[model samples]
Target: MATDGHGGLIQPRKVPNPVRESQSHRELHRELLFSHSRGILPRHRAELPRVLESRRLRQLREELQGPPSDLEQQLRKCHQRLEEAAAGPDPGPRPEFLLVRDSLRKMKLAEPGAWQT
Candidate 1:
């Protein structure tokens, strides 16, 4: 069983590395810019008219770069997890039982027939 800094058997959460995340986003943007310049739009990239593409590029240039959108961030996190899972030891038989048991033990519900509708 795995132990944490607190000496508990609970599994430790995987933390995303900011350096790796920034590298991933940089690569994505570089690829998009290359594709745009070459007029080679991959199916996954959103289709845009030439005018819109120019506008988007300008907007991208102007905006003070901030964190990625939620969906993009989520995809990055999932990719990180997949890479780690592929390279690391298999987590056989996850301790789902412990989770369920803990949840049930703390279960709380409103009174029956609390709603008349």
Candidate 2:
């Protein structure tokens, strides 16, 4: 029940977190990502349908996959804090971070939506 200082109620904030998902694209085969860096793969080469049907597994895989990038270094930085050198503590992250976060909110958490489109 927070107020806006004028008797008006304050609405919930919708800003995206500073932990923006990686934003690089790598048209590489899933074999390279393995079950750690990029994300988890089908156990024993299980079919796509099996992986898709399992909602829990799908979510786990996506988390492990990190973010889409052609380079391993970028992937490693995916979920990490944004590196804005001059940003300092005054302004924190840049404005672009918010845009990146908004796009993520519209995406399916466990699905391959980052590089798909």
Best by TM-score: 1
Give a tens-digit lDDT track for model 1, residues 1-117.
666676786666899878757978889989989998998777655556666888988789758666678998899999999999899995776599987887765553443355345
TM-score of each: 0.24, 0.15
What is candidate 2's CA lDDT for residue 16?
69
For each candidate, what is the lDDT?
A: 0.77, 0.63
In terms of lDDT, the best-performing candidate is 1
**Cα RMSD (angstroms) for every candidate in the order listed:** 26.1, 30.3
Model 2 TM-score? 0.15
Model 2 score (lDDT): 0.63
Question: Compared to the true structure, candidate 1 yields what TM-score?
Answer: 0.24
- Give a tens-digit lDDT track for model 2, residues 1-117: 667686885567888644443233232333446555656555645686676778878788889998656776676675354555344476555699787987787675656656576
